[model samples]
Target: MITLGHAQAIIAGAIAHAQNAALKPLGIVVLDAGGQLLAFARQDGASFGRFAIAQAKAHGALAMGDDTAVLAERAKGNPVFFGSLVGVFDGGLALSPGGVLVRNGDGAIIGAVGASGDTGPNDADAVRAGIAAAGFATGAAA
Candidate 1:
């Protein structure tokens, strides 16, 4: 279960990681297993669009039960379906590479974390740092 504290911890850790890496100001979003937003934060200079992109990426991760980067790779093989899904879901799904699913030691999904306002790899790394800091595992497959 993802309590409020857990959500906040994830966001805080992600933000810290971003700052430590000297990355751009980032927007971070946390979502529960049900795909509901649990917590969110935008850094001082983060762009307005970062919030939506971060949320969409996290939502996409939770929806597909996989990392957003994996989904993005899969989308490349089936653009039509993925493109249609964007329209169907009111653009709530993003196949970008900034989303990471949060899991437990037993590998059960608890939630997701997403970051934006930097390159895809940097965003993903920040999210991973947060999940690790919160004592949770990341759902991205090896």
Candidate 2:
């Protein structure tokens, strides 16, 4: 499980990382292990749909127990399987780079962070930076 404070730190850390890299404004979402939202943020200039994108990113990663980046790769080869999953999730599932699994020191899954409003890789990097800043780790399958 992820605490509110941890979620807030993740958002802050993600924004800071984006700012440092001069990336586009971002929308960030933090979700607990049960796929519930813990915290969210959208920076100025971020598009209106960023919330949906970010939420889907987190939702898909949590549901599949794999990071969105990996999911993206798998989706590329198995489009129909991933497409069915999206429907199963009521359009909540998204395969993209922004969704990264968060793990505790003991390597247990705590939650996930999803980011948008930049390049896919940048979004993923920002979330990873945020997790590290909040004293957590990033993992592929968690």
Candidate 3:
């Protein structure tokens, strides 16, 4: 059960973290465990289609129950299957490292967050910061 406040905090924290770190402008998305969009933001100067990238990252994490980093590694060994999934998911799956699953204190999954507009590791770091700021723990990278 992710509240509106939680979503806002994630977005704000992600943006602030990116800014403070001097990373490029970012686009971020948050989604409930059911893959429903909760909150999104694209920082000024972000490239076009950032929203889609962010959305795909978040949706991929939520749908597969794995962080995007794990998915990326799996995809490398299973390109054919991953390609099929891309079509099946309507291009809403990204095998990248910026997606992370959100968890409550009890370790139940609550939602996911994804960040774009920087290096993959940096994007992931920003999301981690945001989730932490929102008072949630991150699940294991798997």
Candidate 4:
């Protein structure tokens, strides 16, 4: 099991990166492999709506066993399936391009992280930095 401490560290690192970059405040979420929440943070001035969007992004990555970017692309080809999921999840099924899966040394996916309130590329960059800071490998999802 990935420790909560690691999750917290990843979130903190992401927050620091965002601060240093002067990016807009963000809502970040980390979820274990089982798609359970491990850690979360909402920077001051972040949108309240982003709280759920961040979790959805992370959960979508964990559920798909890949990064949200790939899932977003897949959604483009199968909008009905992906769109239905949003309804089923009651808006917690974000297929954005800002979520990343975290893998352990043995290449086992341990969790996923998601960020919102910045552009998709910037959000992805933050997640990558956080995953790297946590000492985990970031696998390409696409």
Best candidate per lDDT, number? 2
Off by over 4 Å in 2: none
Candidate 1 C-alpha lDDT tens digits along 49-142: 9989999899888877898899899999999998888887788788889999999877888888888999988999999998888888996444
Q: Tell me how far the alpha carbon of residue 16 in candidate 2 is from the true structure, in angstroms, after superposition.
A: 0.4
lDDT of 4 by residue, 64-141 (tens): 788888888999999999999888877766888778999988888989999999987788888888888888888853
Supply the global lDDT for candidate 4: 0.86
Candidates in descending lDDT order: 2, 3, 1, 4
Whose TM-score is higher: candidate 3's or candidate 4's? 3
Residue 108, candidate 4: how far off, in angstroms?
Answer: 1.0
TM-score of each: 0.95, 0.96, 0.95, 0.92
Worst 10 residues of 3 by lDDT: 133-142
Q: How many residue pairs clash (N, CA or C atoms closer than 3 angstroms) in each of the candidate models, in the order given?
A: 0, 0, 0, 0
Q: Name the runs in model 3 displaced over 4 angstroms.
A: none
**Which candidate number maximizes TM-score?**
2
* Model 2 lDDT tens row, 2-40: 899999999999999999999999999999998889999
lDDT score of residue 25 within candidate 3: 91
Record all residue pairs in model 2 with backbone atoms less than 3 Å apart, i.e. clashing.
none
**Overall lDDT per candidate, in order of appearance:** 0.89, 0.92, 0.90, 0.86
